[model samples]
Target chain A: DAGITQSPRHKVTETGTPVTLRCHQTENHRYMYWYRQDPGHGLRLIHYSYGVKDTDKGEVSDGYSVSRSKTEDFLLTLESATSSQTSVYFCAISESNQGREQYFGPGTRLTVT
Target chain B: AQTVTQSQPEMSVQEAETVTLSCTYDTSESDYYLFWYKQPPSRQMILVIRQEAYKQQNATENRFSVNFQKAAKSFSLKISDSQLGDAAMYFCAYRSARNQGGKLIFGQGTELSVKP
Candidate 1:
């Protein structure tokens, strides 16, 4: 797990509730990414940031949103959590956005009931 | 669209033996990169090995190596001297050389079990 850290490693929440996961990095990497892992789907990108206040949608960005306000903090928010959104979320940082070597955090396991 | 395929869903190898995991990718782009990632029970995605499409030489890292065939669009991971700690889910990924956000496309994944 590189120098990245994610809060609330495990959480059990109710459906329709809102949730926000935080990813903090000690390394001043320029790129940050948010991904989700499920049983069948290996891992799908939810969102990514190139710099502070810059973010973009991924393949599965429908029910999720992300924000990066500083060099070390990237946040993922689920405005309205759903059962389908329950999955293991991972945060990664890379020095370059060219898809170079990315260091991942431990991961946050969110469960929606 | 680029796609990665890991044919083997599950694989077993004996301790101290060797095993190979196959991965094939479909892409029209000529320049890109291929990588092998390991996700153990701890659930952290670790970079196992990487190979650049332009590089002809195979990439080797300690106990892990990769056989990259650009012509056939194939990249396989070979683990030598397997250990029980090697048991984990391995994922094959592809990244285009373009500046198109640099998103990684991953295969379904193959679960590797090391039998002691």
Candidate 2:
């Protein structure tokens, strides 16, 4: 509803394969974030970008990487997917300030066998 | 590090009745922000209400309001005239006020069921 779209909404892949999830926003928000949601763990931030080519790691950044080439596109890549990495990924966008409400994308459900 | 806690894993309320969901947070900073987000079965996160730490008055949005106790570090959401559509998983979140692009820390979430 926030003009945010996540491609490959659902994907099932075998272990040790490379996977990439795409998040595109029409709002051109300055801040973008990638998060994973699991049972019992509501949501864990993986990586975030402040601007084009400016990124930072979050609490759960291990084994995952993110790149922001433009203001509206942020990509999350899994170098070698593992069973443990299977989870629902969400992309969020916000303005350039703190405490602002974040708008979330529908989400991508990735399953690794 | 800031942390949010939602003690109730599940809650229920009758339609047109009132319900309250509890949330507590731990943070060293005196200034921050608290938020409540609702995620329906659709899995889309929606902002239900928000409270600024510096403001003493609780935030009220339509039938939704918050009981923010800054000293106690407790922020609870009260929904009045609950509707069947209110059934969803509610998450409490916290963000730092000092930093730009501050990432949010969320609670485990409380699933609210609206009974008919």
Candidate 3:
């Protein structure tokens, strides 16, 4: 278990509402990633941060945004929720020397009505 | 661009038996990494094994082992003496060796059921 946790394990929000999910890690890892899991799609990267205040878009970055102000915290926000955004979101982290072997958090299930 | 594909959507194996899951990836780069991640009912992604493309020998972790065929671009996972705990969704992922933020391309997934 990597010391990673995602707040609001589950949530239901209406369409067009703003929602933000938080990922907190204690390992002080330099790499943090956000992914969404859906049926038939194992998991798709949403966004990732390499260090404090440095971020990049992933394969599926539309409708989502991320910010990393500190090493331990990463935030993913949905500016306006939509039905297509309903899915399980996961947070993962890896050390600088570990290459791409990432450890994942428990995950957050968000529903858009 | 890199892509990973898991042809089997579902598979089942009897307890104590051996089962192999198939994975194939497409990449122009010769240097990269392949990984198998297990997601149980708890929904936690656990790293089962990994193989570096440059290595000729296969990689193994306890009961989990990988058959890496670089020329064929195939990576398969073999589970020996399978147990109930092995029942879960298995995912195969590919990452380039280049320092491109270590992004990973994942397969759809294969749901593995272990019969006890």
Which prediction has the highest DockQ against the true structure?
Answer: 2
What lDDT tens digits, residue by residue, belong to model 2 across residues B6-101?
Answer: 999999999999999999999999988899999999999999998999999999999999999999999999999999999999999998888646
Recovered share of real interface contacts in candidate 1: 0.51
Which one is best on lDDT?
3
For A1-113, candidate 3 gives per-residue lDDT tens digits of 78999999999999999999999999989999999999998899999899999999999999999999999999999999999999999999988523459999999999999
**What TM-score do all the candidates reach, one by one?**
0.97, 0.98, 0.98
Q: What is the lDDT of residue A56 in candidate 3?
A: 94
What is the lDDT for B70 in model 3? 99
lDDT of 1 at A44: 84
The segments of candidate 1 whose C-alpha lies over 4 angstroms from its true place after superposition are none
Worst 10 residues of 1 chain B by lDDT: B96-105
What DockQ would you assign to candidate 3? 0.62
Candidate 2 regions with alpha-carbon error over 4 angstroms = none
The alpha-carbon lDDT assigned to residue A88 of candidate 1 equals: 95
RMSD of 1: 1.0
State the RMSD for candidate 3: 1.0
